[model samples]
Target: MKIYRIANLAILSLVLSIAFATAACAADNTVPGWDPAVLRDASTIKVMTTEPDAGEHWSNLWVVVIDGQPYVRLGDRSYVRIQRNTTKPYVKLKVADQEFDKVKVEEMPDMKDKVAAAMADKYWMDVLIRHESHPMVARLVPEAAPPETPSH
Candidate 1:
């Protein structure tokens, strides 16, 4: 009886552990868009990209809001993680303690000048990035939230 009880308890623990991990993974897979007000005042945001070999990679980046949207600019030879975003456009972002997952990334060359100006306005050092010969620019847009289901 003692052995049976111990075996059952171990199985239960395993099941519960798996359930919690699944829940956490699901939560980390999707995130709602940041509030416009939050983006306006925030100076920096963390970006997480899907790395083919390592799963996910994170980096701190300067952020600028242009027309109520957030954008990040990378120099031509900067860390290549942001470039991987071209193929796997889904990314995770964090501003302060707020986390946004599964946001869509889209390259925006047309907005280069506007984003550069915004960056310069937000960060004095960004003036150099704004002048880079060929900077890579991308926009981060929040994914639509899942619809709520009726509770029974």
Candidate 2:
């Protein structure tokens, strides 16, 4: 009975260690093109979207980070850009001095509430804007780096 109790305590310790390790790993996994420290604190970022006819359209807008991923909310005018992104997910993001090219933009309707909450936390204006604008939430996924060629 003493041995069984010790084994159970060890198992519990192992499980707790794994849980803490996973949480730490997630905290370290910062979104690309964004400095982890600034992602949640920066006021705005420059986003360039490809327009079907008008070429690249650039706009500086508020960015929110949720679960280590970067998201942006678009109003009626910018919402059209999100539709355009459905076909061409490629986009450019400028966060401070860092610029990320060819990043994929995916609309995340399911994360609207979460993104809005993050936005409200970051910006006081969002408290009022959230009520006035029916915004669409979109996630920015970094483009995968190209494979390296083997030198002969």
Best by lDDT: 2
Show pairs that collide, candidate 1.
Answer: none
**Per-residue CA lDDT of candidate 1, range 76-115, in tens?**
6333776655446767778877887667677899998898
- Displacement of residue 22 (Cα, Å) in model 1 is 37
What would the per-residue lDDT of candidate 2 be over residues 109-142, giving only the tens digit for each residue? 9998898888888899987888867567888777
Provide the overall lDDT of each model, using Cα atoms, as 2-decimal numbers: 0.74, 0.78
Instruction: Give residue 150's lDDT in candidate 1 (0 to 100).
Output: 96
* C-alpha root-mean-square deviation, each candidate: 16.7, 3.8
| Model 2 ranges off by over 4 Å | 1-34, 85-87, 148-152
